[model samples]
Target: MRTNILLASLVVLGFACQPTKQKEETASTPEKIAVPVLTKAWETDTVLLTSESVIYDEFRDVLYVSNINAVPPTAKDDDGFISIISTDGEILELNWVNEISAPKGMGIIDSSLFVTNIDEVVEIDIPSGVIVGRYPINGAKFLNDISISSGNEVFISDTGTNTIHVLNNGDVRSWLNDSSLVGPNGLLHQGSHLMVASYGGNEFSRIDINTKMRETITDSIPGGDGIVSYGDHYFVSNWNGEVHFVDTAGNRTLVLDTKTKGQNAADICYIPEKKLLLVPTFFGKSIVAYEVK
Candidate 1:
């Protein structure tokens, strides 16, 4: 009778230990799955002029790009223009809008398109591509990127000034005046915070619009130029031809690296509906698209 009891106790002990062993095995397993890097979904043929930046419009299903190079060799004009391309990588139209000089980063709000030039912000009418008005900044040099707030306030980065400025009703004020903001290139509005990419500092920062407090989330990125937010993740690209995916908690991992020469991955935009990422390469002279998945 005692031997029989020992056998039953051993069986119960084995069953209890089974769950612990399974738990250990499960805890040791890796949770992060490697996302497969995909080939370039599409690449536009070399345009007549060099392309400097790109932005995607999900509502219109179009990609707007800024071409800074002069088309005619002897035109004696450095006036920049915008180009509209389809998602399939076809140049739908060239010279969609002409007359803006050295247009760079661009953003759309409603039917209005905002573009930054050498020292001013030019607001253009979308369909017509006509310059409606211009906001000029004194002592401002190299207006790099612009982002619009829900309140209709436009935030611009002055790389030369190493400051971020806000424009409301033509009244300009310094939103962030710090040396760490040097070479601020891209701006994106996330919730009530403003995400700024500083190329000179090689960092990504989040600014509380309400409190005016700044927080540096990352400083390890090289050549940080453009940034965009998708869901809970923020994607930032460096001019060195690499893209980094960062989570809300400040964890970052390399998403993509291109062999394309020229550290000029100037701007990037995400189109959620199509799961597409639009990147404009300054040296590549072309816009490349990749599947977000």
Candidate 2:
């Protein structure tokens, strides 16, 4: 009987140790996955304009940029304008949309241009440049970038509130308000995730569209201002004039460096049809274009 009891106790101890051993084995297992890298396809030094922000319209094959400066001889009060440029680095229209108050983030949705200015999200007629409507944001002091998801939901980052607000047909509500995101400036939507360029925090965050769960993809992207998705890679630009290419696996590489000065790079737009990258400078007051292969 004593031998049997000892054997039973040993069996129970072995069972208990089995789960701990399995947990240790699982913890020691390596996550085997391939990471993507950027190959230097081509580079160009062709400059465009002094645009503070840029966005690409794939359907129109054009790039839209915002110049955050005083409009010449106008009562615009340093209000900015949007410029439309061709793929070959030609300024199609210098003042695509006029009288915009320091337009920072721009998005093109269904022939309408959505821009964040001051603390409101305004919609403009793309061709006529007429202000169609505006959505007032409460508790938002400084609004930055705007992004549209596949479901036509508009997301705007409120720098002052340290939150991201979602707008659907003029109904505005908070999507994310976390201490981790400080001065969210640039916004982009890829797949079901929203990519944010946190300027004050010097980091980038990926948030789920449905659950709003966020994960910090990278940090210390100084002057993190603009973000765009191209092919299978995501490109982020800093006001320091550095462009980083991040692959699907979240590995980043310094792809292009610009010569602009003092918070120069603000926004980036990828024109896939033309294989071009459009970068806007804030203080340098110029737009730089690069050929991406």
Candidate no. 1 TM-score: 0.84
Show the colliding residue pairs in model 1. 239-263
Top candidate (TM-score): 1
Q: Point out where model 2 deviates above 4 Å.
A: 1-50, 70-78, 259-263
- Clashing pairs counted in every model: 1, 4
Across residues 1-293, which tens digit of lDDT does each residue of candidate 1 receive?
99999999999999999999999877864356444354568888877366767887767888899877754311326478889999878999888888877777887888888888778888888878788978888888788788888888889988878888888866888887777676888899766899988888888889898896889888878778789887767889887888888777777788878745563567788777777877887667788888877
What C-alpha lDDT values do all the predictions have?
Answer: 0.80, 0.75
Reference-based TM-score of each model: 0.84, 0.78
For model 2, how does the per-residue alpha-carbon lDDT over 180-241 read when each residue is reduced to its tens digit? 78888889887788899988897887989779888988886877888988766688888777
